[model samples]
Target: MATLPNPLPSLATSGLDLPPGTLVDTTLDGTWHEPLLWYADGPPADLRAWSRLRAAGRPLGLLPVLVTGGRRDQWPEEWDLCPDAASYPGDHDADEVLAGYWTEYAADEVAPEDTGPGTDGTGPDADGSEGPGPWPGLAPVPAREAAEDADTAAAGLAGVITADADEWLGGARTALVPARRSADIPAAIGWSGPMNHENDVARLCAVLRSWEDRYDARVVVLGFDTMIVSVGRPPGTIEEARALAAEHYAFCPDNIDQSPPYDLDAYAEKAVLNQEAWSFWWD
Candidate 1:
């Protein structure tokens, strides 16, 4: 994957004002040649920590990302990052990657009886309506205007998560990584959070990049196997959400199949409609 010249190695000597932090290079294949990231040793209890980090890091080509250890109490060093195993997010097309996964995993699972129009001639069955085909095309961009700018929404969401870091992140700390865009942060760090579902995280990042353009979404927090993004534009109605649900299903089937209310309609109504933050977990 293409990457910028790592500045982490020079962080201490470069005279950037920063809190005491640790530079991480630990990966699956021993230590990496250059520092992959630098994370605060202490929890950023202040809500302004993210914004502060962003201001300080942006000029140096370092982007901010919240890293959670999850239930295992593991930090980045224990997460087994593998930068060499990742591909560039821009290398793949979003629709193609999503359709490929839909064909492989969703085609066989969605039976005709489960998704046809209601018997009463209304639309969508009682359980949950499915789109015309297995890989329903990408959801349309919301017609309603966004509540706020994408970056602003991201900063606000980051503050919310940081405020309750222990409860939401298992004491995860804020980290600065060298990434071209927010969507590429995971692939930049070689996060294997979705390894069970997709080994190449950049493919999913491609979908995220598409979301960044269409919905004004930004990657906010990442855990061992979960990701939460802040959406500037969210569907305003059930119909719009139902359409978006198809993409979510393809992106992470476990978010629907393994979770309660295990139907697209329910998942859409509860998770997508007018919601600013979208969380995905891969089982």
Candidate 2:
């Protein structure tokens, strides 16, 4: 994968006011060619610290991302990161990726007889509670004006999550990564969080890029195998949310099927409709 010139090595002399932190180069394949990121030793006491880091890092081509050590006790060092294995986020198309996954996995969850044209699987016995069928297309963007700027909403949501880091993140820390965009943060670190589902995280990032453009979403927090994004514009009606839910199911089936309610409509109403924060976990 192509990359920007790493500035992490010069962070000490970069004249940015930064808290004491360690530069991480540890990967599964031993040391990486350059430091992937720099992270503070502990959680920030307040959200101001995060805002400061983000402001300071941007000029130097660095971006801030919240990193969690997960309940299983995994951190960046133990993440087995493989930046070398990731493709650029811009290389793939989001709709194609989601559609592919939708087509491939959406059928598996339902019986072969239950899946076909005109059957959406929303019926009570269908896998998704909606009738099971071929991939549904992307969700429509909300026509209503966004409640807030994407970046501003992301910062606000980050503060909320950071304030209660233990409750939301297990034990999360702030890290600055070198990336072109927030959606690329995971691929920049070569995160294998969704390895059980999709080995290449950039494909998922592609879908995120679409959300960034359509819903004004930001990649706010990342856990060992979970991701939470802040959406400035969320679906305002069940019709809109139900459409969005199909995309979510294709993106992370576990978020709907494995979790309670076990129905797409319920997941849409509770997780997508008018909700600012969208969290996805890959099992």
Candidate 3:
């Protein structure tokens, strides 16, 4: 069994951290300036901090809340699961949401039969072989590094970031990393399949637009779905964060019903094309 790393202390105290080894999760196009949103709503620890801050009128910088009861172990493949749920914010079930996200990507990568019992292989391999060999693993893009790359790619129009969330009184200790491994996304293709729906794409763009409007940041680094915006200032309350995210979600014009499930290959492309999605760091 793979031994999971302990939750990073920085993220534990605030809400985000830049612990080393954290992977980037977005595409090049997503490098636009905006904060990555991780939704959680469950236990007291998870709910209390978020609720207290929101109730007190803190912006929490787009930390959306979603309720679930599963453990992080349930979503081992998900990079957003917060390694150890014991230190997760408020009542949000980080595991379930991450699992759902990963499941969507997994669904897009392989056929039903290939994802059978005891099969760790995601979807069908490029060669359509189920036997374990070198199955593609979903990788997250880092925030700070990604920002640098995006800046380099955009010829100075964009810049990268790696700030300590705790540095800001109300900032979450979230760490941002680069979304793409290389500046060249198209040339760095890895997975195969559709990862997001039109609605999802639209929703992401809406969020990016909102963030861009609020902050001057723009570019997609990590994945297509993620958008990193340059914020002149970070929100201090959870309510403010929710308000921003809700507005972004509402901004999307696509229909969820018409959207297909997440595919690993598609998710990979999203991470590759959108630079913002991959850049994950504290606000």
Candidate 1, residues 1-283, lDDT tens digits: the string is 7898988888988667777888989998899888888898888868888888887888888889888888887888987787888899999999899888877766555434436542111234345655335456788888999988888899999999888887877876889999868999989888888988898889999999999998899998887788999999998988788888878878998887788867767778899999999999987
TM-score of each: 0.91, 0.92, 0.22
Q: Which regions of candidate 1 are displaced past 4 Å?
A: 110-114, 117-132
Tens digits of per-residue lDDT, candidate 2, 1-283, equal 5678888999999998777788989987899989998888888868877778888898888988888887876878888888887898899998899889877777566334333343223333334544465566778888889977888898899899888988987887888999878899888889888888898888988999999998999898887788999999998988788778878888998987689877677787899999999999998
Which residue pairs clash in candidate 2? 120-131, 120-132, 121-130, 121-131, 121-132, 122-129, 122-130, 122-131
Model 3 agreement with the true structure over 1-283: per-residue lDDT tens digits: 0112212223335554212322223333432122223222212232134324232222222221111112222211132322111121222232333334334533443434334322223333457655222322221112222334322323221222222212221122222221221111111121111133221222233334334333333432232222233333333333233223222222221211123332222322332233233232211
Clashing pairs in 1: none
Q: Which ten residues in a row have the lowest lDDT in candidate 3?
A: 184-193
Q: How close is candidate 2 to the true structure, as a TM-score?
A: 0.92
RMSD of each: 3.7, 3.3, 18.8
Comparing 1 with 3 on lDDT, the higher-scoring candidate is: 1
> Candidate 3 versus the native: TM-score?
0.22
Deviating ranges (above 4 Å) for candidate 3: 1-195, 199-203, 224-229, 248-283
lDDT of 3 at 50: 32
lDDT values, one for every candidate: 0.82, 0.82, 0.27
